[model samples]
Target: AQSVTQPDIHITVSEGASLELRCNYSYGATPYLFWYVQSPGQGLQLLLKYFSGDTLVQGIKGFEAEFKRSQSSFNLRKPSVHWSDAAEYFCALRRDYKLSFGAGTTVTVRA
Candidate 1:
């Protein structure tokens, strides 16, 4: 079985501050990783994904994630976050046709 965990339930950051959302996964073999963002009342949108090859994958909206096999972590980062970045972020793992998601992290931006 595969599972994803997002340690942070909510995070607050000032506008223009750097942001890092932690994600960890557990699986028997190498797992496909993904990051998705969802705004209030909106469908989930893919932010980025890691399948094979590069451990560092670039995502949309100035986001990037690094996959570490040793630690089984795929943490998401933003160099500088904007107020508009406020949303719920989820880390998901896929193996086969099923996708399991983390609890989700809510990011809040203060001006």
Candidate 2:
């Protein structure tokens, strides 16, 4: 069994501020990790993913994530967030064929 947890339910940040979203997972072995974003009414879009190789991976839209095995964390970061970046972010874990997701973190941006 595997599970993902996003401790932050909601986060508010000013435009141009650096943002970080936390994620933690539990699994018996190394699992595939991913970060996805969803707008108000749109479907989820893949932000980034870590399949293998480097622990630090770059993603679309100035986003990046690091896979920390010791901490069991895969946190997402953006140097400077825009108002458009405001959306619900989810952390997903996949093992074999089953995929599990975190509760999701709602990001709010203020001008």
Over 9-63, each residue of candidate 1 has an lDDT whose tens digit, in order, gives 9999999999999999998888999999999999999999999999999999999
Question: TM-score per candidate, in order?
Answer: 0.97, 0.97
Q: lDDT, candidate 2, residue 38?
A: 99
| Number of colliding residue pairs in model 2 | 0
Report the Cα lDDT for residue 81, model 2: 97
Candidate-wise lDDT, in order:
0.96, 0.96
Candidate 2 wrong stretches, greater than 4 Å: none
Instruction: Write the residue-wise lDDT of candidate 2 on 8-49 in tens digits.
Output: 999999999999999999987987999999999999999999
Query: Which pairs in model 1 have colliding backbones?
Result: none
Per-prediction backbone clash count:
0, 0
